[model samples]
Target: MTDYTSMANGGLPRISPYQAGKPIEEVQRELGLSEVIKLASNENPFGMSKKAVAKCAEALNSSHIYPDSNGYYLKQKLFEKFGYDPKTITLGDGSNELINLIFQTFINNKVNVVIPAYSFVVYPMEATVADAQVKTIPLKDWVIDLDAVYDAIDSNTRMVVLANPANPTGTAVNINKLKEFVKKVPHETLVVIDEAYNEYQKEEDFDDTAKWIAECPNLIVSRTFSKAYGLAGLRIGYMVSNEEIASLVNRLRAPFNVNAIALTAAIEALDDTDHLKMVVAENAKERDRYVKYCEDHNLYMIPSQANFVSIDFKRDAFPIYDALLHRGVIVRPLKGYKLDTILRISIGTHVENTKLFKALDEILKSLK
Candidate 1:
């Protein structure tokens, strides 16, 4: 019998596939529910900007033509809006793809990769696929221990990964401290910071890491329109680094890597500042409600600057997660991440959140 698994790349066969949050339609079909609200994937509760949506529709007319291979217009938009250097930018299908590209470009079995615990999961996964040695650093009080991560790096370390307002835990590192860490890292090791939830952070906590690219040539910053910009389905993102790194990653990027509609929508999305502001403001308001809910219920809600909250049940939470699912409220269970006692729930609109609270109240009563 043919053994295809043995022929697979490094750790591909040994690793489990990424389990994304279930779509509303899939839950409806599986459970025979008429209505379901998904608070699993940390997507923007508000849909895409009206301007972006309109642009996407208009772009449908050009579907037959290939998108600009280099995404020139979108790069120009980023440069105009954020003062990013177009030469330092590399377009990606999503920040996930850029992460993979980084590992593929630099990582090898002889080198090691440093990552903090409770990260985005893609970090270690991509490193493993690249056949790199993985170094997992422990968190300090539920947040990434930057100092520990620094100590883990050695000459053989090829990369260090961090996610600001990190996933699952929703805890972020102080920006000033992060800058210091980046400066101290050796020039030989690449520092990758995934800021997918950057827009959701408070104004006081935000700082543009891309500005440091010139000073720290080994630094790479990746961001996406998936969360705050509300373009998850379009899968548009970009990476910022020195021109040398950008050029290397570009060589591996597929032509027309970004589709025409995504490019159009992303360009418009960057321009619609009002819509982005509303999404961030509403997310802040609703996120507070989740904090209070946890406090009132005697649960611990991790401090989150992102658009989601992770509550520690202090015991296996699968039962509670299942109950919520049956009641037409879908939230993330962290069993796969080995954080079985915690569940991460995305902030939704007011009405949706109210419905979730009501359903949760009923479920809690039944459990007691």
Candidate 2:
């Protein structure tokens, strides 16, 4: 038989699979734990809105039909709720898929992509997968170095990614700073902002990229139902850009790329402002609690506007993470992000937060 693996593209073998936060079932199966509180994946612990649930059930009746290829009703709702023109929207299976789609449409071996380092892992991964030239610039003080990013751009640069309220670290730059960076970018180069946690940010912290696209035609802002809407299982997200960019990007999208159930859930989830408000408000409370805990205990943590906090454990975070797992709690360890001493903890409900700290205290005691 032929060696099929050797026949594949050289870069195909180099891709590392994404590590999602452990599922509740996986923990139960592996450890036989019944009462697990997972704060690993920045999930909405409050669960989805009742309105979205009802819409999902209604969508089941028409399960035999294909989803609307353009996500018409969802886009219509988005236009009404957010006031963006329909021509500016491009729907995807998730913002992850949208990220891939954007690269697929613009990238080639001839041009390079400028990745904002320690941001989303997918940005660099996709650039590598496409065999596009990749240039990575590291963070300064755990925040994206926009000045360095601007300096890296050249005639060969096709795209530059900026993750607002960046993942893992969960820090956001101010609006004026963001505008200064965007204004400096070349008009021909695409500037993409991954805003998965935009809804979780305070009004003052948010840059409102939805409004920015109108004036900056080269901008593409991607968001998901997975974060604040509690629809990760549904896998729906959308991209916002000017008509020209969206039109080009949509050409590369597959028909019925988004499922009917996800569409229904996202559409109804928009109207559940009360449910969204509750989720964001609860997240803010837990985030503040963790910040205070860090201050009182002399533990260092990033001041986050996103739904999670990154704590510096002053040593390897893996042992703490494993100990927490054994105690029926789960939090993220950032070894993959090359921060072995830092653990990123997603905001949970009041009960879940209490359980996590209790586990941490016990584990730290045992280790000492």
Candidate 3:
């Protein structure tokens, strides 16, 4: 047999794959636990909207038919909501695929992508696979340093990816600061704002990148149905940008990239305002409760506008993470993001949160 390693692109050789949270069934199998509460992945605990569920069921009956290549109905709904032309929208399997498509469209061996040192890892990983150099700007107080990012940009910089309410940290840049930063960036460089958690933000002053897209021709705002809409399993996300940029990205996107059921469900999800409000309210209450719990326990935690909170253990988080898992509570350790002392916990139902707190209390007591 031929050595396929040699046949592959040498520069793109051996990339580390993303480690998603362990499934409940897998954990139950491994630990022999009956009940498991997953406070990982920042998923909506309430599950998907009823309207979306109904729409998905209707679409599933015709699952044999191929999905619309253009995602016409979904795009129309999005157009009404955001008032952007259908030409400006490009749907993806998820926002992650949209991220890769952006890189594939513009990035090459010569161009480099700039990302925050502690921002989403996908940007750097995808850039590496494209054989493009990656410039990582260190975080300031667990938040993205817009000034530092601007300083890092040079002539070879092709794209800059910012995850507002960034993962693992859950910090966000306000509207004014983001606008100033956007104004300073070179027009030739594409600024991709990944707003996957946009629905969870309670801040009145949050950056509205969608409005800025009209002014900044180089800006792309990507949103996902995974978080607030409770459609993570369906894997539907879309990008809004200028027609020219969207056209470039569309060229690289596969036909029927989004599935038929996902498209129908996402359209219905958009109309489910009551479900969205309930999710936002529940998440807010749980987030505040978690923050208070951390405070009472004297655990340091980053202030978050997103659904998850990054709690500092003041020690290696992996051990505590393992302890929590053994207690049937699953949370994410941020060791991969260089914050070994922090664990990111997604907000869950009241009972689930209480169980997690109880587990943490027991583990901490044992450690002491």
Best by TM-score: 1
Clashing pairs in 2: none
What TM value does model 1 have? 0.99
TM-scores of all candidate predictions against the true structure: 0.99, 0.97, 0.98
Cα RMSD, each candidate: 0.8, 1.3, 1.2
Whose TM-score is higher: candidate 2's or candidate 3's? Answer: 3
State the lDDT of candidate 1 residue by residue for 1-368, as single tens digits. 99998999887876789999989999899999999999999998899999999989889998999999999999999999989989999989988899989889998889999999989988888888888899999999989999999999998998999999899888889889999999999999999999999998878878999998878999999999999999999998999999999999999998888999989999999999999999999999999999889888888999999999998888788998998998898999999889999989999999989988898788777877
User: Over the stretch 202-282, how does candidate 3's per-residue lDDT look in tens digits?
Assistant: 667475687797788889999999988888898989999999999999999998899999999899889989999999999
- Candidate scoring better on TM-score of 1 and 2: 1
Question: Considering summed lDDT, which 10 consecutive residues are worst modelled in model 1?
Answer: 359-368
| Residue ranges of candidate 3 with Cα displaced over 4 Å | none
Candidate 2 per-residue C-alpha lDDT over 1-368 given as tens digits, one digit per residue, 9 for 90 to 100? 99886776635567888899898889988999998888988888888899889879988999999989999899999999989888899999989999989988998778899987788888888888778889998888888888899999999999999889899889887778888888778889999999999998879877668788767888999999999999988899999998988999899899899999999999989999999999999999989999888887678998888888999989998999998998888889899989999999988999899888888878877888
Q: Which ten residues in a row have the lowest lDDT in candidate 2?
A: 5-14
Top-down lDDT ranking: 1, 3, 2
